[model samples]
Every structure is written in C-alpha cells, then in structure tokens.
Target: MKRFVGLISGGKDSFYTIELLKQKEYNLVALVYIKSTDIDSYMYQTVGHEMIPFYRQVLDVPIYIIETNRKAINTDKEYVHTLNDEVEVIYDHLYELQKKAVFECVSVGAIKSYYQYNRIKSVCDRLNLSVLTPLFNLDQRVIYDAIIECMDVVIVKVACTNLGKEIVGKNLNVISGMRVDNWCGEGGEYETAVLDAPFFKKKLRIKNYEVLHHPEEEDKERTVFFMKINEIEVLEK
Candidate 1:
C-alpha cells in the first residue's frame, strides 16, 4: 500500500487537496500542521490557536503539530523567503515521522503559487518523497465551489479589509455574489474552516459566534471581520 502525508492548513486549498487524495485511495499516514509561535511569523494560513484541535477532529487522523519560529528574512522577497522557511520546518517534522518508515509521499494543497509549490516539491525530492498537488493550476472558483458543494465549510476568519462585519458566521452560500467579488475572500479576502467535508462521517455544528471588525493599514483601506467561535458541536446524522 502506498502511504502519503498531507500538509493541511484547514483552508480551501489544503482541504481540497485532501479530498482529491481520498478519491485516489492513498493510505493517509498523518496530517501535518504548523502552529504559529507568534503572530509576527504567522504569514501563511496560520490563523489563531483554533487550527490545532479543529484539524485533528475533522481529519480524524494522527496529527503532527510542530512549533516553529521560522520567518521571512527579507521584506522584499515575500512568499519565497517565508515559504522556504515553512518547507524546512515541515521537512524536519517529516524526517521525525520517517522513523516509523511508512509515508513516502507528501501531498500539499498548493495552487497557482509556483514559488510555494516548487519549494515543497524540491524538499520532497531531497527527502525522496513524491510531492502531489491535487488542486494545482485549477481555477480558484472551481475550488471554492467544490468546497461549498461537497463540504460543510464556515468562515472562521476574514483577513481581508473589505468583508466588513457582514461576513462573520455567515455560510459560503449566504456570502456569495457581490460580497465575494468586491471583497475577494477566496482571493485572500478571508480564511475558512472545513467544519464538515464529505470525507467526514459526521458534520460539525457551530454556535455562539460574534462578528467583529478591524481596520487595515491606510494603503489597504479595508476592514476585516473576525468570527469568534464561542461554541462548537459535532452532530451525528
């Protein structure tokens, strides 16, 4: 049996990657996630502390949450520096997992960003692990639709400035049309959580959320609404 490890961030791309892998019937070894040590180094989809538990329960798989302080060395380099640091941190963790000697493939939820995808690919090459991207080069809208149609998704955080207070706790279907285009939440307008996807045996029911807004820098000029998760429940059907 071929074994694979998935790098999940609990976002659209990562979640979609997992879905595609399940379709291929690869033996999933573990879900690897990086817990941000501080907000300063939190560049990639590293949201708040909610990710650790959320993914564990949702994936229903063994999770390796590594704590790393890796950050971008250059303000000018953007994703290159930051993504390279992340790949290093992930490779180190995977090396530790390799002691068990089960996983030979590392699947990622990368799309469009060759800088991000190629770094992981290079590391996988060095580690002698096959790197697979289930969502590579696909249209962003198709990815979003797949998540909504096939999974129970919710917006846990809206990172963009234009979403305002209207988005927190709202379902994807409710926040469609003018809101998505104007704000571009799918294009980094916000971040989301897969409360329940098709892969799950049960769906997650959430309650007691409050919408709050924050103003971005003068140049961005948009306000983002943070959805504070007060209570969550997993429902059985």
Candidate 2:
C-alpha cells in the first residue's frame, strides 16, 4: 500500500476522499491542515478548521498543522505565487513526515477546480510527490449524496445569500429540503465539517456555538455567515 498524507479541511469532500483512500488500503500516515487565518482564503478552506482537533481524534492519525501565508489575489502570476506558498508549508510537513517512513503521495479533494488541481500538481511535481484526488471529475450530485451516506456533517458556514443563517450549525441532511443552487458546495457557497463518518470510532456532538454574520461580505455579494465553535462532545458509538 502506498503511504500518504491527506490534506483535511474538516469538509465533506476532503473526508470523503480520505474514506475512499482508506477503502483502497492506502497507508494514511498523517493529516495535514493548511490553516488559514483569513476567513476569505482563496486557496484553502478557511472556516470550520477549528474542528480539526475533533477530526484527529476520530481518525487516530497524527496531524501536522501549518499556517497559510498567502493573501487573496486576482492576477494569474500572483495567484500562482500564492499557491506555491500554500504548497510550501504542506511540502515542508511532508518532508518531516517522511523521516519516520517513506511517503509516496499526498491526497486532496479536488473535484472541479482546475486552478486548484493545476497548482497542487505543479507543487507535487517539484516535490516528487504523487498528487491523489479521488473525487476528481466526479458528478456534483453524486459527490453530494456520497457524502451524505458516508458521514454526519454540519454546516459551519454559509457564504451565499441563497442560504439563510439558520442553515449554519445544522447537519448536512438539512440540505435535503432546500433548493440547492450547487449541490457540490465547491464554489464557496457553504462550508462544512464531518462530525461523524463511517470510519470514525465516535461522532462529534456539537453542543453550543455562536453565529457570526459577515454582513460586509453579504453586502459585497460573498460569504454571509460563519459559526464560532464553542463546545463539543464526543459520542461513543
């Protein structure tokens, strides 16, 4: 089995990709989280990363934490530079992980973001690390339903005016009744965290949280609301 380090964002696609890798008998050595302090990070998931600790507990894999330094950019050159910066931290941690044993590849949840796929492939090429995107090119509805059947996820952030603030902090199932503009949730429409999944020994029980409204962005036609995680409990299966 090939050894790998998965990039986790506490989101459905990332977790679902990891689950698929696990089924394929990959040696998941560690999880890498490229934490972004910016709520509006372009290269990575910014919200719901606070649940990473819970994710580690569920997966029983060591986590390598890295901070993202790139600011959001629009130009192709600046965007490429920023992506390289993001990959640098992940690559640095992969190097550290390799001291314990040889790691063959890095895993991600890239589906349709050509920009993300290209940037990741570019860095992995330089690092001699194989880039695995299990969810690549899969149908959006398939991806959405696959996640629903595999885990218990929660909406931690709703970035679209189409989705109300009430949707945040609710389970992924809550989307069932809504008219989803994007079932994939890949376009920054919303952000989620896997509270429980098939591989998890226990599920996360979210007790309390504070909803923060990002009205400025809403006025600007962007992410409207986010949740601040305050309390969590682990429920044994």
Best TM-score among the predictions, by candidate number: 2
TM-score of each: 0.82, 0.90
lDDT score for residue 6 of model 2: 84
Question: Which consecutive 10 residues in model 2 have the weakest lDDT in total?
Answer: 74-83
Q: What does the lDDT read for residue 233 in candidate 2?
A: 82
Q: Candidate 1, residues 39-120: lDDT per residue as tens digits? A: 4343356553464565566556798877777774434423332454645787677888899758879888777666567767
Q: How close is candidate 2 to the true structure, as a TM-score?
A: 0.90
Please give, for residues 96-129, the per-residue lDDT of candidate 2 as tens digits. Answer: 6778757788888888887777767766776789
> Evaluated with lDDT, which candidate comes out highest?
2
How many clashing pairs does model 2 include?
1
Kindly report which residue stretches of model 1 are placed more than 4 angstroms away from their true locations once superposed.
38-43, 74-84, 179-186, 212-222
